[model samples]
Target chain A: MQGTTRTPSQPTTAYQPTDRTVPTRSPDRASYDKELVHSILDEGYVCHLGFVRDGAPVVLPTLYARVGDRLYVHGSTGSRPLRMTGAADPGLPVCLTVTHVDALVLARSAFHHSINYRSVVVHGSAYDVTDPQEKRTALDALVDHVVPGRSGDSRPADKKELAATAVIRLDLDEVSAKLRTGGVNDEPEDLALPHWAGLLPLRKGYEAPIADPGLAPGTGLPGYLSAL
Target chain B: MQGTTRTPSQPTTAYQPTDRTVPTRSPDRASYDKELVHSILDEGYVCHLGFVRDGAPVVLPTLYARVGDRLYVHGSTGSRPLRMTGAADPGLPVCLTVTHVDALVLARSAFHHSINYRSVVVHGSAYDVTDPQEKRTALDALVDHVVPGRSGDSRPADKKELAATAVIRLDLDEVSAKLRTGGVNDEPEDLALPHWAGLLPLRKGYEAPIADPGLAPGTGLPGYLSAL
Candidate 1:
């Protein structure tokens, strides 16, 4: 995994007594360190964004890109949560999470079997990003996150397009990264059961690019996409 | 590829004004058909669960199983949103969504580039599954959803486990599905650019299962697992 840091470590916000969040397996699973958090976030491009709108909870699957300590999410300005954020008391309370299931863990007994994975959950408020420069930078990061050099290659979002889109920023203040990997942990007694158990790994990658029919006769694959 | 149903059909719930939440999509981009909605949901296993806790929105990535017209989700009974359902007001409102990215639509101009995907969004009120029989059936559906025949292979959830776990039920109602698939639609002007544009196909599937090292003699793969 690629690991890089762009900011100095800062103190995390204090935990309030009123917070009702209850984490499972706190001792073995909790991780709040900054590097660990960013690494997981950087590796993921798609995230499941959860927020409550109109007193009802809503989850949206969307694309996200990280820049420094802030994560940027973009969507149509007409989205419910985005519109609601523009006129709200507390803004939108959101839990944004990214997960990658590394492998499946098959145990001798069904109860003990589980999957090995890496995931990060962020709990905080998401406010709309209004500054044009910041929004432009965030948008560039979004483009580059998927294909490194494309931000400069293609025409940037025009004034009208920018106006039609909505961008939101959430600081990575309260977050946790949980991971599990390796084979199953079967009980000694259950090990003798006549059940076959082990991991069935999961892998995700890109295949050959299929050129669109409209492409020019001489165009070839870009280095960045070929590398992917 | 599986065009199980082509015509549009509505689910059991009537389309109320509130359910028509995001009307901003281009006319060709939105879908309100039941077959389109169910097909998207049935093909997806993981869903983004969004809820509110202490007035803040939280989104979590978790496993979900769909049984007939209902969706099943469970976690520790101590979790905030799960517990919130038992408390006072108009029950907890939730939006459960599932998404599958089919291909990357790489346009000549980056601004026109987009992803081809199938997504289903369900809007409704959620309540705890209080009926014991229903809960058991939902749990079995969950187990079966993960691994088709594992529910029969493994020991079912005992009373103690059931007491400690909390499961919530949300019927499939007021739902919508959106899809975009196929090659990039490059603008005529940008076709002359030297950058390559094409669709990068994405897929997910299982690899061979590795038997647990601790299994005893005669413990071969189960018929159901092998079938998968």
Candidate 2:
């Protein structure tokens, strides 16, 4: 929300629905609107990256950044997923998901208890970013994704550092955003019950930033972080 | 941490590591300690469930409850994953992960920027909970997992509700907890840079609970919620 800029022209564009993107349950909660999908993806810092390993599913939490319709994830060159996406190999299939839990829905009945959340799921093949120019931009996006204006404040990665890191790009082609908002969904019969029921909103934000012990004297908090 | 009780006798026990649980990177951050794994899992409200579908991996965020060595996930009987775990089908292989971002680690160099996080990855086979007694207990755990002491105050699910819900159990056989904590890890050459570098801690907690508009008159906020 802070560092990323949205394309105004694509506000009304929607992704074409595919069989895998359509959910079997709660189909009403799913949306293919591009703007809605981007908002959900940009607000989160980490994504659960799912890939098949040894014929079994493996999900790992990793840092990701969205640039236009493409998502980039970087790691050490030797990392399993990064290694699997080599230049010679075909793209690796991955399912990337980001979720934000907004509130805990407390209902009068145990069966009705639920969480209000927004999530986006993307199914695509990830390929290595070999172009130097694109790789550098993706790396900057990754840093700013965590904290806006951070890439400019920090030293850019040198050739050696860039060589050691691997970036994988996944296009946001087959995706869907799912959300559950609003109040409790308690049964009519249970409304009169004595239990207190409503939404317990979860708040997430930054506290006071701890300055590094070795930070240069007189260095001040950047405007972006202070705004946060 | 609030409602779930730890087994005192297993304080020093560690889960036997398997090939899948061992990470290919950051080996030092991975721990097979049972207590550490349970703590990471219990503190989170949702898990990213990864399962293979049509030979491709799919990851979804869903509510989960941990009971001793078992984790239970419930959904509508017709949900995709739930339907896949029918009585006659072989157990579904799943990789369940829970992650908590503790801080945003800002470094002097963009390449070193990282986040302080704790995560647990569990690899196992999930089977439908066919036994009525286990299903009931699992359902209560699911409710209590959201709010401690909530299951007791709320109305238990009736026969029809239980019939509509599907609960699946995954044994905590192959599990590992990975953590990244503490301060910035800036390179020595960049320590003298002017950028502010350190940890921006992320705070997560509930704000005041919003009482349901139709709450019964004179109903008070429950003790369990007040404690939270």
Candidate 3:
């Protein structure tokens, strides 16, 4: 009701889903909302990047960041996925997915068991980020992604380090976010059955910081990390 | 070291590394040991399933279980990824990856900043498991994978529920595990820099279980969940 209603003045950035971004099954769960997609991507630290290599699908976990309508991912310039995006080429085709498991839905009947999760899938080609200014900004966004405000707290990369790192940017086109929320969806007949049914929520957190072995004693933990 | 050395007479069930399974970027971080690979798989609850759809890459998040040398993934028979396997052929060619982000390695230099993670990449075709018995076992394994002893606690799937679920399994034949552990690996010259650098560990845990709003009053919370 209230949550579903959107005001005209509100800047809604819903994505435009292409045939590939649309869900073939459970179409009701798919969302083309830009705000939802960006929120899901921002909350997640790492994403699974799938790309075709020699006609076979290859998926790898890599860090990513969402800045406005664009997503940036970086790796060692020599990394296979990064190297696949050649400068002169049209860029590498990729499917990047980020998922957060909110809870485990335990249904009375095994058939209805599922997870309460939020996931975003992006379909696009990743172009090599060549400009010096854009590359620096992308790299900073990545650091702040893992831990917000981290880039400001830490030192920036030098010119030599920048040369060794490669950043790839993918526009948030043909994107969709799918999710399942609330309690277990058990069958009508099974509701009266004896089996227990509920949700076991999962949470990710940061533990007490273990300073580097070589960390100078006077060097205290930064405020940003300590708060986490 | 002794851990790296293999003794004779032990069953060598290590996965064979094909051209694609090998890490092209950091080959030193890859391992083909069976024990190591299984350990990493067992530690993760979810996996990224990648496959080609209409000549484009699509990646989805799904639950999976490792039973012996095989990995089983199930979804609603109507799900797109599951339905694609039923196409007029043996099955679908898939890339399944399980990753555990252990810690964030904050290096003094941005280029060396990385996450200490353990990930397994399995490249092969997934065959539809139509056998009722195997399907039942796979489903049970999937439930147990989330929470140990959960399969025994919950009700088993009835015939009707079984008909609605589809299970596909991929062999751990062409699998390889890659990992980066310990603290940050900063450049030797940057080591003397004043910036702070170390490991920031990330942990996942279960929160308080919330009972279904409609749960019967007399039904008690299970001991297993309470313990967690």
Ten-residue region with minimum lDDT total, candidate 3 chain A = A1-10
C-alpha local distance difference test of each model? 0.71, 0.90, 0.82
iRMSD, all candidates: 2.1, 0.6, 1.7
Q: lDDT score, residue A122, model 1?
A: 84
Comparing 2 with 3 on lDDT, the higher-scoring candidate is 2
True contacts kept of 3: 0.63
Residues A1-228 of candidate 2 have per-residue lDDT tens digits of 111222333435988889998888887777888888999999999999999988989999999999999999999998888888874377999999999999999999999899989999999999999999999999999999999888999999999999999999999999988888888888888999998999999987988999888889999989999999
Q: Each model's fnat?
A: 0.71, 0.93, 0.63
TM-score of chain A of each: 0.87, 0.93, 0.92
Model 3: per-residue Cα lDDT at residue B109: 66
Estimate, for each residue in B1-228, the C-alpha lDDT of model 1 and write its tens digit.
Answer: 222223434444332224454445543555776556677877665677777766667766666778867888876787666787767366578778888877676777756667778887788777888899998887777766767777776655667768876888888766767677667666677778776787888757777787766667877788877786
DockQ of 1: 0.57
lDDT ranking, high to low = 2, 3, 1
Error of 1 at A119 (Å): 2.3
